[model samples]
Target: MTARALATTCAATACAATALSLLLTSCGIIPGLGGGDAPAEDPAPSAAPDAAAAHRELPLTRQGRMFIDGGGDVLLEITFRKLQHNGEYLMIEVDHDLLEPLRASGTSTDRTAPIRLLDPVTGEVLRAIKDPGTGLSLGTYFTEGSDVTPVHQGIPTTFRRYFPAPSHDAGHLTFTGSGLGHVPGLPVEYVDEFTPSPEPNIHDYFNEYAEKTADELPGELFYPEEVPEPGLDASAFRQGIESFVDTAESSTTRSGDRETISLHADRMFDVNADEPTAEAAETIRRTALTLRENPGPGEITVVGHTDGSGSDAHNRELSLRRAEAVRDLLAEELGEDFTLTAEGRGSEEPVAEEGGEDDEQARARNRRVEFVFTVPDTAAGAGGEGLDSAARHVAAPAVFFEDLEPVATAEHGDVELNVYPLVRDGAYLFQMVGFGNSTLSDLEADLGAGEEVAGGPDRVTEGTLGGFRLLEPDGPTRYVVRLVTEDGYEDFADEVLTLSPGDEYLALAVFPAPGPDVASMTLHAGAFGEIPDVPIR
Candidate 1:
């Protein structure tokens, strides 16, 4: 067709499809748009066979976004709403709440226009058509009379929305008339993603949400059957395990050369869907930054989990979906330095007890996404794995002068200083410098970059990089010595220490030592300049 002819036909098609699309826009059974087959679930309340019990079950993607009318009165709300797409079209399921005055009052509301799908990025208004005789819809206490007439409280108003499916690269969009709030960059799953829930379980599944029995509740209680172990025991150590940090929402534990960080699934996901909420994505992004700062040579494993809810198949699918979602986000942030694997453990091996129906809160704890980091065999195994590791950060420790030995001494005016190497093992090395004031006057070493080093004896600066150059090693390096305290580590340059008459002061320095061969290093003393080759022993 010529450009003009195609344009005319396209406009006509959109216009022709609008009316039917409005009827199918409410949700479920999009007529011709549903990839062809109509789902088993009932259609709109008017099109379905039942009116005595028009139940609109809540969907898996509800986000509880309020859609208020011109007044501040919330006319509609979306909870657990999610968006999906086939290669050809977009499928959106919204669990909604239509809070009308009362259906018995015969009150009605107005739907300003058929739902509008606006590509938030390009401002393009995509057209949609009625997918007749296709899709699934069910309702209870829901009357699909007009676009507005919501049933009273306790009855859910849910539906499936279909658009011409945006470009594959399209991310978020805003809805004006029917649905509201922004849509996420929903990754598409094939139209026949998986066979919908088995036939018999259909009603049982949708109806299940109406009655709160699923252990998949988040922030809700599902007490565990097995008592949580009071604390990790020594036996845990023999299993090649090291130390661990844990909290209600997340936990980081260590093994030989591996560290595993687990973030509760509820913290990262909602209901049975896989797309992460913005809050969850932010949390993941933070973790990625930490890893960048503390780069580790290890394999990454992302584990997705669900609580004891739904069938084995359903839980497995949901868990896998969530894990894959997290993996994608992590991959984007972490880059190619890390090899990541995404897997799912459907409620199989829960950290909680073999909880039954009563374990609602306990089950909440079970839903989580875990990241397992496995480092190079020997390097990671030498220590208690990540015992000393941060998300990728390190802080200095407190230094005490009492236990240190003077490896070198220098006197600057009224102050005498001595250096001591306290610990030198593995990647970390520490030293303590003690200061004593022998004169009546208080002493403040104007070390200021320790310029006195160049002025000190050649014997003092020979073979060394000069001053505290030893403090800053060259080439492939490890941790370096810096002033450290119980409060946290800081640069020696940042310290403002004073020594009074007859007073003794101890200052600590930390370093990322490269090897175990270092027997001595030059200690740059304030004003005193470089103390020649201070012995490590």
Candidate 2:
């Protein structure tokens, strides 16, 4: 049968036992055989076949436990009724409904299904005799086998069998064993009653839990600190007053000598100086008129400042506004073509220190603005040739290998390769070719030969590749070379090269990349000949 059909069948079987219990309890009838009660033996058989057949076909009831071995390791214990039979076979019916939608007609009654058998003891399979045309079964027989044995003998046997059931099903099982007298050495047969529990929904549980847990927390508050009280210094206060008086006298003299006008006032400007102050406006107009009358290479810078009475942020904004006011006046008078820059130094670099009590006077000095002029270098007599003559020229390139030839030799221990770049007339020539070394001990040990040196074309740049050579020796030997820059370019080579005694070699040098972008470099090396037992250090 299909898996789904088998599962449904098992589910129905499990529910059958419970349904039977309820039904029997409702009818005031006992559903199971009483404990410690034995069935009475039948009288000796009669001679007539009809009488014997009647006796053998009598309805039988049994309760049994079931067991499965290799087929599947599961058990089922059940109680069932051996309903009716034909000839030597017995037909047993379970308490639960074992079939599901057996008839497509969908109107069949829910009834206990029959488990047909051949013989109760011999453990032989029974085949149903059916009409050739109708394909209807006459009766069924039980199969015989040695593997079958009685779960219980003499007394009514408890039948147990394990069957696949739906995921949430529950049930019990029942079957007959060889002790039923039909089969001599057969095992018990089984029946199962299964019922499935309703499936659970997860989302509903989660939402309910979340809502219950969300009802228990508090709020937040914030308060700012108070501003510090202002302090006054008597000595500093006197000094500031004196300084102001001195500045006023100096200003008067400077204004007179330069033929400029000056103004002293209780208030520098109107409440909102965002727009140009009258004096600033007049000054910007006069400056622009003068520039128009005599245009030349000169620039004007408008410096802005603010009082220390306010916070830094507020003072900065006020300073910027004051500078912008002057700029607007100049721009409007000069027709936007004038090259002018404005800067604000809010409460910084103060000319007069305020003593807190003279806050107004301190603010008056800080709030003032001024204009500075810068003449072009040509007019300043510098002629603009600053630092150009003192610059250094680029150095020429030099060949790194000068003392060391294309090929050289060294014994064990220290072999030094002297390398220097070649420079001609201010131009550098010939980048270092290549450098490498081999061990004599390695060759002698591995190839049974002393150290040997090999030179060939560079695989990357196709340039000539060469290195030092050392003959067989007992101890360690090494070779070193330094690369020199070509022309005005900087150059470098591998730091050092060392070779152990015996047979071994090493090649270390900078080479160009395989493709274009010759500016790129890389190092290459290898060991050959026999390596000595000395440590790599």
Candidate 3:
């Protein structure tokens, strides 16, 4: 995968002494005992008690409460107060209530910005818009001069942010950020026009600062009359996808309109030789079946790569020969209807770094063959019956393993991992993992250091479960954790939690949903080994 840094142009400032303390209403906070101009009068009762109750009952779709610190201290409660549809943009409102006191020194310039909305089924990630002139993300920073006001203990602060309105028809989208984890199934409320709240907003504060320091900052402060509204650029937007592993020998990845299947070259050929092994044909045949099941348009490009062990010239020549050999066999398996091409790029692209303590394992990952092509629109989440043999390559889901569970639990040292049943949310699957620290002192666990199953790849990140995967109980296909990426930012579906002694941290992982017909999966939890019979809801 190509890496791009997500550039952020906003920062937090020092905490201001003044903030509002408002009462809770159905859709928003009632403006009450805060410092502002005259508070707007509360709306009158409409004489419909049931309707008001229903409105108040609207739920915020999120997992367990998120904490500022992973040690279960410093609880930070978040609420999706509103999602109003404005012209060309969606106005998002969120409330942050920090239960514990945060010191003024604790305020970080890098902490306050950017929220994303992900439409799982459509694979669209929506980011907050930046003003073309200033490149500032269009959101509230609660700034006082140059620093942002920290959330004082027991006071709730509401933030208003804006993103380009989704072009799709999804009624709900997943809300995610560094503070709030993956919050799925949030309903969007539509409005015909945008109205500024009576709250003391960031613009008013920033505008005052701009005037006081006119020598340093010179520009039009706030433009309420001419709000920037950029048109939707659908053609330029890139779609993200989940990676699936059927076995140690191969893995499948879908991105936007294309799909790429990677096969382990070491398993297909002998050392320093381009000839296919006796067992290579079966793997190729299974791959052919997968292609036919999820048929697509355009020429399938077969690319070969080798490890950085041999001479560059020799390795390139050998990789080319291997690519040609695989292309010839694929042509025989797939009839004359499909066009195929071959190329070799020996050691040019390496997914894992080489000169490390686990150099050999990284080298093993570098040697592979890839088949790239465009997948048809109907192919995603399309179910298929894979071969019953151990080398199954199909994308079918597992429907068994629900009744046989007390769930599964495992331990590595003082840290214990308890993986709960899976929950399916549209195009994604959510897995909640309960972590417990049994010792008297805090324990540090390195998830990336877990031993691989049968020489498979290691975990990608250390504290989080980024390298872990979910496998089909009846087949070899492994559904990896969905990676949410933007510009230069990337994170797995899990969090980096600190395990305090006798305390528990319930984390989350979002994976690509298999077919709806599937019911059970096996989690390859790093350090904890294989946990089977994990039922999906």
Candidate 4:
């Protein structure tokens, strides 16, 4: 059935608190919703029908499910109410209810989990507003004079938060918060203000006054009045979202119009030497090509970093020499069109932490070279080709697949992986996989743990499915999971957990859609190895 038809069925069934489970169960039939037509041979005998329910995507008015670890089988029912535009801020309202009693009351804090809005057109993630003076988020807080009402089981509690208004005139914004992962296609409504006050509307009073700086506004607006400050516009609070595209040779991070291309130092240098290695030629050539496509203000900054294994002084000097060496090669590639400057940071700005079981792995990641430059806004992803253009997109509503059966399966030890066919949506393609443990004991699968030489920079989080990527069936282009950099680098994907014995979990990963001429691609499933011939529908 079509999404519209599903919506009609949901409306008829009344997506209420009592019918939330029914809505989630019916979602399975919507082509790419969740668990669909089962395969003839069961690869994961422990897998069940509801393994992918946690990653279910639903409309704003409909009730969706969220799986909270250690909450047992009690799924949270989230109903998005509004993405209303206020005077200077955007207000988001949602009603949440716990399916069963677990001796815990839902608090407003759960609704404030790094709320962000995705601009599908510009590939920007809009963040919540914050108080510049106090450096505190301008949303619901559990401090004094605030509502600390506890949300009981089965009780629908309404919560609202304020955010920096979108700078564009888009009709809709994709809303993602805490467990309500990427509720795409949320209609944006313009209103003077929300009436009757949303529950835990701690800072709604800011709406009464005109947009002003902390000092310009009345002292009573703050908890402890201090020196008055100049008022600032909403534009000043805008935080740019960073987009990442990874290749075997280098990784590129695009923030706004600026791009930071990171190449592993190991790939460019031998041991602790400063000279260029044989593999450095390919990476340097790729970087030069990207710079030519998205030329900036004629100046590029090259920075170097190193692991914490060496002494501070030696590491700093070595990193500097390496940076200068790489910068020289890049200058030669770009000729006199760009002026490249080199600097070294040593271990001061390490991307990954040290002193752990994965310390060596983290050190390998930290040892890299970065080329930072600003690209013309028009030049960024201009032709919409290659991996860079494909990285900056979100999944849309497209359903051409007949069955959600696993087209490929890979087994490693007791862990089994079942990958479904790809679902092409707009400029993005969505892929789902079922991870099952055949053992009777509990399984702790860390998909991101890879021992190979680092391919690119990674986010700061651990135990995520960030290692998953897609390879062109017969081409050189590789696509990594789209990173949502609102708070930090988080995968623009959703997941369901398998914490019990004889259980299977389902997860999702989104990537830039390949060209229309391409029909299938190879999936790189971290520990499960590579699954080939995954059809795109």
Candidate 5:
């Protein structure tokens, strides 16, 4: 607009290629127009902590195989980024499309990075972390049914808290994974300390957008020329739970000649651990009350049983540990007033038709603690009396849930949904939902899992939520949808529901805990309405 500057620009255009054509825009006069040696500013404010902060640095010690969604959908020949640690927490950073072959071209796409850490020596799956982010954008309906959002495929997202470090001295800690890892063993490097130096952050598509203010090149010069093809309406993915209550009984039992109350041992304790979980306290209290109401000090037997899957020795030991746990509870509750005996009978007296099956539900029947009541022969017809209804304990399966009632009902277009905010464990809340589609057209329900659009065709690793974001509330550390495929269960992130007309299906959505102080959170899907006060059991 200035006369003198206009004349100078006109003269420069005459020799544009020599001086001003596509090179002069390199200065900060227009950010991200050219390459530079200057150190870049930190894009994330969270990374800025006081130097005195106790954050420690840790190396991934292995090249992390990059998959599009933890699967080999697109194996990005990527370099393993470094990791920083604080206590059991970890922060990992990876190169974003540093290689020309992996750069984003045509259209911008969204991606969910699924990560897993395995023991170098034994490669056992210790835990699973899910996408803690609700996978719901706060904006428009366009991103609703599709958890995919516009993102520069070439820009690094600095995936935070992929999984917590197992322990402090857990060294030679090999982090191996299957997803998209065409090659075995990511090269591990040992670093003495984590000294983070700011590197040049490649501006992503959004930040690289061209502007008209500088009379710069059109948007295509930076941003992707095309937009991703829209798939399903992702607006139906649930976000968070608002309130919680137990609508279904935790358990149910069948009657026999003798009244036996079987408590699922799995829910009371963690994997292979003997102590009862905090939630199990409620069940123990109820059990004590029922026992107190029984007439006379009848002989009470606490018997622990196990499924036929594990070795006889291992199963027997597990059963005994569980029996001791129950006996301890009784000893604490009744003191010396009651005669209690604890016993372990492994893989014997299974109640399930497939109690020997590896299936969790079938195995659940055998993974139990039974309370057997025997009356004294002195009382008239005492042997004839069986356990009352109160003697049977009720509890829904802890980790696995089935036929949970919908706390709220919702429908979008032809998608009828019944949402079950089933229960909350230490770190995450489990949700089960049923979807029925009655329309003639094929409907896609964005269950908030996987990449909406394909990135590349060359890579495939375990893209499922076998490992993901960690949701550390005030309680226990929980994964978003971290699932180790057992029986019929899989992580929620690895699925995309495609329903033809008159078709129906069920889905699971795992979200981060809203913290203990907050009892409820509203569940939101893309463009559809929100479901509030969805209870947590």
Candidate 6:
């Protein structure tokens, strides 16, 4: 019969054919069946069904029984969920019936028959199976009776169950195809030979298979498509969002930075009515909004200043009221988010000089409350990156003075004087010198003529000017030497000075003509330095 005809006949009655082939040949229906087909060219053994074609005939999902070449008279029956193309190895699920025929067909005296699964596309023999107990092996064949050999060494077989359930475990059988000189002569190619366990749910098994396939498949197969743009309006929408964030950041004032909004009140309200104006109220609202938007750990100083027109006491009170008004508004609007303090400088620092037509403007300027944000030194250190150069300047060493006094006394010519030793360490010292030119006679009479000051007052010492020694009773406390000049001469005082722990020094108090003929006096402190030139009248 022709190959196609034989294949058709086999397909029509594969089971019956298998049984008939076994029985007829063994019982001699065609004499000398194993030697060769004879008489009228007995169907040339159906050209050993092409393994490639056989594999194509195998179903992807094993819903029905499958027949695979099990070598000689044995055939393998397979039932599989899915067949996997694992590059080098093809994995499949086979039912127990797949092994039954091979196990039964082999006799105690015969050599093992080898069964095989082949890859027709690559012409590769992928895996082999053999049963040692039955002396039966299944794999790629080299010659016609290669499977009939007793020592089926190269064939490898593994058995496992694939279950669809809570636990998805599948059995794997792998055979190295590189050992095969050429492709196998198996009837079924790329056969899935392992059986799946029935205990697992079928749906789960399929789901697992799909998931695995997805993972193993090449990336190009199911990638998502590129999305199209949304048009020019989309750009505008995005820009709007950015603008929102920028505006929010700009409006928000940092906690310790200087506040931009300030408050001012006219002199008429120096005593009271520093109430909030509509504009000021609005400004406060804006400031509060800014502060609330950008919260931080800092304090705002509400400094109130005043023009020099009013008495110091009244001006201080007025400025404080103005500052308090602003503070109250901020507190009401901002709540507990900010730390605020109110202070008044009174007439101490005038924005403009006194005695001028611009007094109104000066008054307007001074009648104001300014807010300065102050970050604590510790906080500033922690947030150094946020601090600007000016903020850093504020923290630099400036000037601060505490105690000042007179140290010694002297008399000369018409000048009887009190000298004060100025002590200082900071950048510069400040002193207000007073000149009272009095006669020496008045000084001598006042002091009983050179009578020394005995055991001077506490923390103060009286010492002789020439000798530069403190009186025996005088100790190491800081002193201010006072000098009083006679009439017609100016009185003088020294800027603050610093005296070391132990140092001896002489300071001279000189008297000269007072007023017109009035002579100036040069006062000196020995080791600590001398006072600068002063005008005496």
Highest TM-score among the candidates is held by which one?
3
- TM-score rank, highest first? 3, 4, 1, 5, 6, 2
Residues 239-303 of candidate 1 have per-residue lDDT tens digits of 12132334444555443356667777777776787899887877787667545543464478889
Where's the lowest-lDDT run of ten residues in candidate 5?
22-31
lDDT of 1: 0.40
Model 3 has an lDDT value of 0.53
Residue-wise C-alpha lDDT for candidate 6, range 175-214, written one tens digit per residue: 1111111111112233333333233222123233334422
What TM-score does model 2 achieve against the real structure?
0.21
RMSD of 2: 46.2
List TM-score per model, in order.
0.29, 0.21, 0.69, 0.58, 0.27, 0.22
Assess the local accuracy of residue 68 in candidate 4 as a C-alpha lDDT between 0 and 100.
Answer: 31
**Global fold similarity of model 5 (TM-score):** 0.27
Ranked candidates (lDDT, high to low): 3, 4, 1, 5, 6, 2
- Predictions: Cα RMSD each: 32.0, 46.2, 10.5, 12.3, 23.0, 46.9
Worst lDDT run of 10 residues, candidate 4, spans 1-10
**Which regions of candidate 1 are displaced past 4 Å?**
1-241, 354-358, 376-537
Clashes of 3: 14
Better of 1 and 6 by TM-score: 1
Could you give candidate 2's per-residue lDDT for residues 14-78 as a string of tens digits? 11111111111111100122222233432212110121211112123322111111111111223
Which digits, one per residue and each the tens of the lDDT, describe model 5 over residues 451-507? 211111111123332222222222222233323333323343333324444433434
Distance (Å) between predicted and true CA of 159, model 6?
85
Error of 6 at 286 (Å): 1.9
Summarize candidate 4's per-residue lDDT along 1-537 as a digit string, tens digits: 001101111111111112122222212101122222332332221132221222222223332233333323344565666677655567665555555543232111121124456555455556655456554444434342322222234445454455667666555666544333334556677777544343323234433433433235442221211111224454544555455565545566665667777787877888889998978977687667667766454898999989988899988999999999999888888899888899998889877777767877678778899988786432333223322422333334342121356787888777777788765543456676766778876566656433332434345234445557778744434444445343555555543343334444555556656555567888887778887878876
